[model samples]
Target: MRLFGRKNGEDDSAERIAEFWRWWEGARPGLDAKVAAGGRDSLASLAETLAPAVSALHSGLVCEVAPGRNAAHALVVTAAGDAELRSLAHRWALAAPPADLVWEFHPSRQANPQAADLTLRAGDYEFGVGKLVLGLRVPRGAPRVDVSAYHPIFSELDDDTRLDAALLALDSVLGEDDVARWVGEITAVTFQPIDAVPAVHLPAVVADLASEFDGEQWVALEGKTARGRPLIAAARFPLRPVDHPLYDQHLAVTLPYAGRDGDKLPTGASVEALRDFEERLTRVAGDWVLAAHLSAEGHRIFHLYADPAGEVRRQVEELAATWGEGKARVDVAGDPAWSAVAAFIS
Candidate 1:
């Protein structure tokens, strides 16, 4: 389908009206004089057939066609998912009869015309449309047409019933300049809370955690040995790599912080630097994207995990090196005792 600019470009409304008139006048050529005199039916068999074909394709697309919009020479379909739609388009192209044609697909969102031309330039045809778009190609004499389509997220359906329903809803779009299809899946919410005990080693619970939280690893927030003081150990796990619904809940309720009310202790520059570095690390790591909570009961310590990406790591390391190697313990984990613990660590 080719859509002409009705507003930004030339006078498209006038162009459309002219094209329609030209097509109407040329409906029949060299008609029998006697039949013409008898006033033959205006509708022709070829026109009727072509109309159905056009309608079939148009019924599946997802774009809106205005009165002066460009004419549709092909079909456009909109599907529930971005990726799924692209995949289907590819399959259809592979099964189509060969012809001299150009086909392609883009895996990106729609672009504004001010930034780049949304026109698809392939061989002799130039299609200028907008939105997340894809195209297909069929070489002359090839048995199958080539397909190109865009990929989107959260629209995949492996089940036949769901797929069928989604296709039915999007059956109107034969082709579009802007089309967004399914891309990926949304992972289920999961949480793993590690148990910490003072002066004792906790049992490993990897298997249990895996079953409960879809293969998540659970580390005991405990010390290396039973004889050693049960210090707060770090429990690291991979987040779901996307926005979490419970993020605000986790932040407002979980961050262990109690600013000085009246009993204020002068914090040295070292402490200030550590907090600043921690905040930076949190921002880079996307630590705030997921919901996590620290319970009031566990032997807990709050520290920022350094971002392994830049000078932050080097700065943190250099700061640590300022003290002797063995003397860095008090700073790294803080004193493994109650008095040195932050008030929020309660």
Candidate 2:
């Protein structure tokens, strides 16, 4: 029940990250000894050192030690279902010390096969994973899956506590990262429904649904600006914010091209320059992170999402400055909900 990390703004730099690893290298032996001796509060007791060090990287990030997949333990840095901080947890895990026999690193809570037989206690309620039942809902024509969880203990707990346990059970089976990406709204019910499947089947059910979203799909959206001016956009389908939890930060680039046939889409030599801009921007992105490419009124707007820790803003701004057609404007904002592109996404 003790959450680790500070309640202060994060310091995103190499210094804090390096400092944690340096401390980790020295503390490993002690930690291993404590765990090996079966200390009841082994990892939890390290809040003084381990907690502050990690909180320095990002206040929202918290760590816990769990039964490992292969190693003796897994040092998991989890975002606790906060999509905005998911990327930061991943970044922190990426900077971990190389793998060793004692510990493995995880960016998010992972599926634990052992959890199936585990009994979890919260307040006066005690329950095991086996007591849980799951119901899945796949919305028609949507790219995601919705899940409902049922447990007798839920009937005794408050709404918030019940949901916390339900999510915990799901994360234990489906893994945090995947659940964040592929799963949508979660509902908690005290009684098992006829359609409810056993908790153990959640992984397979979610896997089958996730596989459907494996390939890329896009849709064209035709709309008009506030002034009633016509605009068109090509955007990815199944545009769920959960799909790209890490892409919380948003970037919008306004590229003005002289050549266009009133649709505002790029044309002539301007088309080549816009493509070059896209290529350069993607290199900065290192992937096709474009949320949408829209032609609005007289200018072309590119909607993009990225990790705030990355130099996306600076890099994209630099590219805009070198725009050939005319002066380009780059705007960036933290948009973890991805609401900026709502108009474009179908």
Candidate 3:
């Protein structure tokens, strides 16, 4: 009796599947062409048939079906009545020619406008046919889901009950052939786990210094001293001199500091002091000093990219007299190595 019932159930499933295919084939031409032509009426018609199925999967669901590449179909599912429809329009795309599908879900859609939390992908792996940008978010107090079955989709399933129901539905609806096809497509795509890449480790002192100078104008490099103390170096390109014609013949002047009153550097003193000193230097040197660098040894190196007026040395001397307090020794060089250093530091 059990065997007979199983045979009957299989026959019924096959008949239903055949019916679905027939309906799809009849609707394909009109739906595909109209959607490809960007017809709203056709989309609404297609949505009438598809929306219920998607809504059953998720409450308050909005479903959109449109033409995809080569007479294929694309489906976008989102929260109902979302005013920002354009943002979710590309969430799920399906192509039938080579049997491809792509799905992206943004858990923090409002907080992060450009974030894609989880991505489900299948089909041709190369030429970007099945590519996904993965960085999923798990709700703070939600239960975790098993990831072995479908890693990307699993990352999205924070509600355990919903996940179980969805899994059951998927298993019931998908046949052996369907599962095989999906598995094949999924296996074909390549993916890298987010945890695979090692995190950058910075010493505490370097991190603190970097935080202080973090801005659009400066880039900081972290190194280590002889005794393993964190050494921080920074570079900045002055906007004023960058647009000048004499930008290429710059000389870099290095001035060492020991934190004494006469050898104090403005950057080491305070952020405001650094800004004030930079402004004064720019005013005095004009277009000659195009950039600047603060070395790990606390040396302020000025990039005088042009010395057309032969005033590079004079400018360095003036800077030392005004800000260096008579203890700073200015070494000005116009060598090719200095230019290379300036290029690198800037």
Q: With candidate 3 superimposed using the best TM-score fit, by how many Å does residue 4's alpha carbon deviate from the native?
A: 99
- Cα-based RMSD of the predictions, in order? 23.9, 4.2, 22.8
Q: Model 1 Cα displacement at 230 (Å)?
A: 11
Better of 1 and 2 by lDDT: 2
Lowest-sum lDDT 10-residue window in model 3: 106-115
Query: Tens digits of per-residue lDDT for model 2 on 44-78?
Result: 67544466667766678888777888888888888
The list of candidate 1 runs beyond 4 A from truth reads 1-307, 320-346
Weakest 10 consecutive residues, lDDT, candidate 1? 196-205
Span of ten consecutive residues with least summed lDDT in model 2: 1-10
lDDT per residue (tens digit) for residues 34-55 in model 3: 5566565765676776654444
**TM-score pick, better of 1 and 2:** 2
The digit string of per-residue lDDT tens for model 1 on 219-260 reads 434333344433333333432211121121111211222332
Give the clashing residue pairs of candidate 2, or none: none
Residue 267 of model 3, lDDT score: 49
List TM-scores for all candidates, in order.
Answer: 0.19, 0.81, 0.29
The better candidate by TM-score, 1 or 3, is 3
Note the clash tally of each candidate: 38, 0, 5
